[model samples]
Target: MVLRSTRLRLHVGVSRVHRWLALIIGVQLLLWFASGLIMSVLPIDRVRGERLVERVSPATLDQARPRAPLDLVLREANKPAREVRYRLLLGREVAEVELADGAVVLQDAETGKRIPPLNAAMARAVAVQAYRGVAPTPSIRAILTASTEYRAILPAWRVDFPDRDATRIYVAQNSGRIVAVRNGTWRLYDFFWGLHIMDWKNHEDFNTPWLIGFAAGGLALAIAGSALLYFRWPRKRRRNK
Candidate 1:
């Protein structure tokens, strides 16, 4: 009789513990489920703005243009260039030279003059090349400072398209590299991603204190539930028999 009483007490204790833990961890579990479902359904390419923006083909250098001698251009620079390559910049053939200090310079192959950095018009033209015929006139906004989207790459250009998704592409000023591409779908995905990871600040870290606590609570709840089942199921079967 004492053993039976002890078993009943243990069963009630585990049941109460399971109920309390379920109340605590159930909401987070639902959030995890919802966020995961949303992420799984959305197409990744559309979220990345890949469908909205096309890659610009490398501009071909005109072989017919009479270029300045490499030896003369090097002498004009008065320093040994680490690397030199001929490429078309803003429809002009130029020698892209990397100096010892990792600085990139563009020297006009025809006149042997130092080509200036791309201006607004030049930047616009470069951005226009990165799209299909649908958005020939995307609003190009220049951001010299770091922004939320173009955080690391500063002095970049934001090329905004008027597509249904409102796609935006980031282009670097110095290298003209397409740094990032994002859209409305990407923003929605990012929102749920933050919730899923439990990191609202950086939206990347998953080892937060809140998540750890919830995980521990959930684990405890699962164990308690299993214990309750183990104690209750046999008793119900025996009562039926």
Candidate 2:
């Protein structure tokens, strides 16, 4: 009788815990499901704004053209070169020199003249060339620091288009390259992703304390519910023959 009473009390306690856990963890589970569904339904390419970008063949270096020697270019840069790349910037062949201190300098591949940094007008031109969207005019601004929307490269140009997608293209000022493209769809997807991971601030970390705690609670809830089912299931009585 004592054993029966103790067992009954334990069962009641477990049921209470299960209900509390359900109440606590249920909302997050629903959010996870909804976010997952939304992410799955959204096409990855559109999310990345890939369709809006115009594909262009990379400029090839002409070996036949007369060019300044790489040694001369490095000497003029004055800084120790960590890495050097020859590429065509706009229409001119330029030597992109990455200095030992991580600063990038552009030099004319033919004359070895130091190419000036990209101004707003030059940045706007680069954005226009990279974008295939029908937006007539785009407002341009220089982003000197990293932000949530544009973080890949520093000292970039943000060109905002007045289109349905509210497209924003980030062009690296020094490199004259399209670093990142962001639009309205991406923002929506990012919002839900932040919720799913429980990292509202960064939207990157998946292993948060809140998530861990909820996961533990969910596991406990499942175990407790299973125990209740086992204990409460009906059993057939033996024949009284």
For candidate 1, what's the RMSD? 4.3
- In model 2, how large is the Cα lDDT of residue 39? 94
Task: Kindly give the stretch of ten consecutive residues in candidate 1 with the minimal lDDT sum.
Answer: 232-241
Structural similarity to truth (TM-score) of each candidate: 0.74, 0.87
lDDT of 1 by residue, 21-81 (tens): 8887898889989999999999998787777666555678776779899886776656778
- Name the best candidate (by lDDT): 2
Which runs in model 1 stand beyond 4 Å of their true positions?
56-118, 144-148, 235-241
Per-residue error at 100 for model 2, in Å? 3.1
Scored against the true structure, residue 26 in model 2 reaches a CA lDDT of 93
Residue-level lDDT tens digits of model 2 in 1-241: 9998998998899889889988989999899889999999999998999888753536798989888888899998998999988887677788899999998888889998888888888878877887878998899998988865666878888899898999998878777778888999999999999999898987888899998888788789889999999878888989999
Note the Cα lDDT for every prediction shown. Answer: 0.77, 0.86
